[model samples]
Target: MEKLAASSLPMPTTIIADAGFDSEENYVYAVGDEKEPRFEFLIPYGTSVQEQTRKYKKDIQNAKNWTYCEEEDCFLQLKI
Candidate 1:
């Protein structure tokens, strides 16, 4: 997460997901150690329960301290 944060890339202001990330444990885990960057979580729409997972998926383990917003919707450009 630190590497990603320091990389020469545009940081995202917000992120969204399903009920997967609404857990208190994950919320606490998402909280960063440094005392500057204030990352927040944003859960995607339709779920309002918190889930505690031992670990995040391989792809998203590095996506720490990010808030999930639950109000956004997505559409496929072209589904196959």
Candidate 2:
């Protein structure tokens, strides 16, 4: 993210990443806090972690928490 911020390329409105980059810290950084820009991020949580959280499982079963990106034309299963 810091690299992207430093690059000449324009900042993306949203970022989509694989489970390899999934982590609580990463989520907070990408989404930012009150003082920083809240860049949208769509990264799946780790399967092991998701399996352990009842709310996560319930949301998946209910299909009520998906984040859809029109530009990418894909549904992001889990986002933070």
Candidate 3:
């Protein structure tokens, strides 16, 4: 952690993390985003997720089952 902090490297504006880092502790540390402009994190947490998918099952998310965004390279939830 020290290596990542003391490198004088630019922090990412937006970060997407796994559900493992989605706790309140991580959220508090994410306040650093305020210091660094555009430092936003889009971490996914299954427990916090409340979106209902009629077409796709939460257990299995296949590439063909969902729409993809070329820019984000992730599945896009289409509201129909």
Candidate 4:
């Protein structure tokens, strides 16, 4: 973004990017100073869609699938 801002090319009215470009710094830069804005940003969180899928929900490798053992204070390994 710094390079783009310093470049001679005209700034775009809106900036559309994938999850890879989603970050706090990018958001702040796009918002500009005060109430002004450099451009409209359309970026989604990286896990926005993947977390809702059945594959992600059932995947043994995903931490969310691990069952916590309160007494042992650890996550039980899931058997295939």
Q: Please report the candidate that would top TM-score against the real structure.
A: 4
Instruction: TM-score for candidate 3, please give it.
Output: 0.45
- How close is each model in CA RMSD to the real structure? 16.0, 12.5, 10.8, 5.8
What lDDT score goes with residue 76 in model 3?
76
Task: Give the whole-model CA lDDT for all candidates, comma-separated.
Answer: 0.49, 0.75, 0.62, 0.82
lDDT of 2 by residue, 1-80 (tens): 68877999788888889889988889778757774746878888777556667676557544556778899998777743
Off by over 4 Å in 3: 33-38, 48-80
Off by over 4 Å in 4: 51-80
Please write out the lDDT profile of model 3 over residues 1-80, one tens digit for every residue.
33666789965567788878878767667765455533578878765454455444443444444687899878876544
Q: Which candidate number has the best lDDT?
A: 4
For each candidate, give its TM-score against the true structure. Answer: 0.34, 0.51, 0.45, 0.54
Error of 3 at 66 (Å): 27
Candidate 1 lDDT (Cα, 0 to 1): 0.49
Selected candidate, larger TM-score, 1 vs 3: 3
State the lDDT of candidate 4 residue by residue for 1-80, as single tens digits: 77877999887877889999878887887887885887787988788779888888878988878899999999976954
Q: Candidate 1: minimum summed lDDT over ten consecutive residues — where? A: 50-59
lDDT, candidate 1, 1-80, per-residue tens: 45667999876665555775566655554565563435665754233332233343222434332445556543323211
Model 2 accuracy (lDDT, Cα): 0.75
